[model samples]
Target: MSFRKRSEVVNTRGPGLQNARGPTQDSIQNARGIPANTRGMPVNARSPVPARGPQLNTSRGRNVPSLNNNNPSFRGRLSQRMSNMNINDDSNSHLNNHPGIRPSPATSQLTTSTGCNDLDSLLGHMGLPLGNSLLIEEIGTTDFNSVLCKLFASQGIIHNRLKNGNSQQESNTHVIVLSLNKMWGKELPGTYKGSKKDIKKQNIANEQSKISVSNLNEQSSTPSRYKDLKIAWRYGLKDEIGQKNSKSTNQDSTEYKDYNHQFDITSRLIPTPTSDEITYIPTNIPVSSILTQLTNAIDKNPTKLIRIIIPSLMHPSMYSPNYFKLTEIIPLLHGIKSIIKQNESRCVLLASCFTNLLQSSISSSKLLLNQIQSIFDSIVLLEPFQQEMIQLLEKSYKTQPNKIQHGLIHILKLPAFSEKGEMCVSRSEYAFRNGRKNFEIEEWGIPVEDVEEDENKDNNVDSSASNIGNPNNKPKKSTKVDLEF
Candidate 1:
């Protein structure tokens, strides 16, 4: 069966998965919507038989939680179950029995006009709940943005298919891009524009991939960085600073170092002086008009899985100000969550922090943590693993086993199903709620013990400079000389 190409056309019949997953996994669909294209959700079909596994027989001698920590009676039963099932890393325990995971009364599937049955299977139910937010907070950048974009794209695809009165299985899903950094052009959340540079700069072989760097400073007042006025203003600022203040000590030097001056792009954003020089967008944004297009998409796809990924490649500080906390991003986030629900798709909202944030002192109103939290259904702080926290997740799941029932099938579901199929994966998915409340950075500066001398030196230097400027021709001598030297 033929499908509509990118130009857009409607077709009433054919197999959907065959196109994306190659001809093998393809299943034919008649006049109705078909299955396939299920990138985000999990396949819940009860396998008629256990899938084959290698002969490592790795199931035996499982580290089974220690007796000290695990209740003996429960542990005996749990151990017996584990022995019977023999869960390994490769094998999924869905086929096995569990006393804890009971089906919800609302477990029925939501039917869609879209022909894709796989989408439903992957999503468990047809859609995500209203106000449900999936936050993936991690330090590493691997596959983070890509996976998120796909999730958002998949959601949008389903929504569009339903909107068209056709099955998503039967039609093509298009998540128009609003703006971004590092997205592949193939599908979901649309294409990724490497950098927002002009065509000339884009041609440069070594031009930095925007996603590789992170911006720490994103302004709240402005919308688009590429705007002409913003760019011009930024250029002027840089020129002025280079000439006059390059050697001068900055008042906020402490704050700058707190972020480690992360311009090297190891884990954060690069600072851009003006809005227009936002030559890179690590978000893989599909559209050129970053700000306006994103706002528009948010308005359009409340029920779709729309991802506005501000990758860690950009300077965190550079982008944070324009992020949800800075502007009216609440409406956009609400729209995003709403659209996913309306369209019967799930939404994943991921925000990455840069070195700037780490470098900055912890202060109220700066992180805007609470405001950002309200935008999401759940939050995950993906950083280095802590053993105590892991233990907590395990304990919580044992007592409240049903907490992550739907999560069992979701691949990225935090605290995923333990390797054994028993509830083991710690869904510290709500990382913020479960995360450390007080995380601070320590850096030695001029200790307070030496503060008096330093202050005296600073005052003396300032006074001398003032005197140098007042010799009748102070404007010429102290006129902030544009040091040609």
Candidate 2:
């Protein structure tokens, strides 16, 4: 028996074995051409795994998965489960804290005063809701809306200072001002001193505290009424007294204070060198960089509340008349909305835009403004106060003669989550004025002429009585007041 070298020998005993070898050789021959370009590759190299579905060999087509396919891998399933788990956990935690905070569809439950009580009353949230944007839209060419923006900024500053115990040092919050141009800095609203109403309320609360202290002392000295005291010395009478004393001391030392202020638009906020509370950013900065800088500033002070005041959002100086045409506005607003939601606990945004700018744009692109407006939590349109309405308001309210009438506060939209979010409510109209010391919003009342009509009827009877009492009952001739040349 002669045995050949193992590499050269080919075993063929049964026909079945030869049949298997025939198929193997054919498969080898089919794969050999695939790696022809892959020089130095081993002939015994493993074949590529087959694709799940039949594939076409189109030159431009890629070997991607089918469009309507599911990822059934273990890793994919695990990631999906993790995302669902996280969502459920977040929902459960939010529901747990639901009692403490009321959820708003349009705005956050948290709110800060607009610094003007009347304006607060007009808003559904009773103030500027946090984590929401307040849009101030003006119809005409007046800087009155700017005054509201200033007041909003000033209030935040004042509240921050007051929160820090009115310290002359640094404040506890940040005020970011996106000024349309250089003029806004010179005209920033000033911090308001306590108004007469604020002072009066403070005094009343103080008086009540004193009275309560006196009453507590009197009660302590009167002695316990229970005669069946099992442990007069050990019944915790001493502990109770000590607890009360400690509570009183704590109350006295750290009384809660309200930081809501009434801002004065006529004066400028006195910039203190040490207190860098207000940060001014030029509106001309690139839209992409705006949010980045804002994020950096906010992160710098993680614990501080943030107030962003954007005045004249699309002013001609900062942007072209056709600025909305640029795609940047959409992303900019979306980014801002995201930021506000992320920091809803301590962030508030107040922005103003002139309606005329949108109106003058091509009618087809008008929806851009609406889309922008929709992103905001609330919208307030300031129409030029009707001259007749202003006169009527002036006559009815009898405000100071020198007070310049502001604008009509038309609440176009209220925060969806607010207490009274209805937009159909009657006479949501309000008249605002820039007084010497304050910016005020008041209910727009019916004209005084109507009220005078009833008074005139009463006066007719008085006139008849006067005539009856006097000897001259004859009516006086009508006198023409108009003089013609």
Candidate 3:
């Protein structure tokens, strides 16, 4: 075979049978010129590039290129934009400085006190929010729920008095009581003052302190001239210090007026509310007339905070048997609810019902109660202690009278109008004591003595049985000999 370089090899085939070769400069130039340039210019000639059309922005039409090129962190730019925006949107403008209303510690919504600090705490909001209704259902015939209604009414009147401060003009808080009782104003509780014994103890303590100071002064001997000279200066210093302390204490007390006040059930509201501050509506009237009157009250006091108190709801004394019909009661309540919703910032409703009166055997009565409870934003069921439970409590708290509980409080449902939509029903058993000075709610628990007795009994039995296992313990020998088999 003849040795020949692959590059110089020639084929004897037709002219089309050529070997593949690398691109030459002339071939590359021809390939580049194949596409016609309508501008009729040389490829290498410099020409002004046509201005680019607006780019199709896929990122919601944002300037993504600039954003990405300038700052890699999008969150930083977002924070900068947020910093320049107004944070106070003022959606709750009506909540600002409204009398008798305070922002809830839990939800931060505008709320008013229910006149009982413990009851307020039980509601989980620390107070009752405006535009919502609270239905208190009691099982017994005792009128303990009526006491709460009075407190609710009195709180409104007191708030009105405090707001206007001796002004004869109409008050800013209006209390509308749905009852025919003319002496309702006189029945409201007054602010609590400590018992005589407590006051006496305080006075005695003060006297003792003064006596000790006087003794200390007497024990020290000083020159008469110096003593006389320093007495005025010392008094002057004391007076200055006292004035400063008083100013500080006064400032602290006035910093935020208490949202709830402690009331004494034994005393009546002094200088009862004026006619302008409270309105009594008759519940015996037709439901339509009641709705009309409610509407008129709301309309008349457009600028005031109205507190509606419906005490003893569905009681035979307050309402006729015909009023119990679902058609009549439902529309009445729905109307009141609508009014509250319309003036959410300035209205609140509190009503009490007797669950014992509702016949469970009758489906309609049971349904009526359920529907009424559903209408309210919150439902609290109060079950009074039975005779047996009462005896136990009395015996347990014989020495500590103040610790005795009168009834059990069941939080069936709490208001769910907050932005978080949180609904909480307290599962833990809670006991309530309706005291003369306050209505207290506390965690329910068995007495310590009872628990101790139970533990002692178990321990005694265990100790006796455990002695059998002890190696140190000896068993008694039988006196009589066993019979021989």
Best by TM-score: 3
lDDT of 2 at 132: 69
Candidate whose lDDT is highest: 3
Tens-digit lDDT track of model 3 for 432-456: 8999989888999977556767787
Stretches of model 1 off by over 4 angstroms after superposition = 1-131, 140-169, 176-178, 186-362, 365-367, 384-485
What is model 3's C-alpha RMSD? 14.4
Q: List TM-score per model, in order.
A: 0.28, 0.56, 0.64
Ranking by lDDT: 3, 2, 1
Q: Rate the local accuracy (lDDT) of all candidates.
A: 0.36, 0.66, 0.77
Candidate ranking under TM-score, highest first, comes to 3, 2, 1
Report the error of model 1 at residue 178, Å.
Answer: 5.2
Model 2 stretches astray by more than 4 angstroms:
1-108, 163-170, 180-183, 194-256, 272-275, 391-406, 416-428, 450-485
Q: Write the per-residue lDDT of candidate 2 for residues 181-231, one digit (tens) a residue.
A: 545555667766567898887786566457577757755776533422566
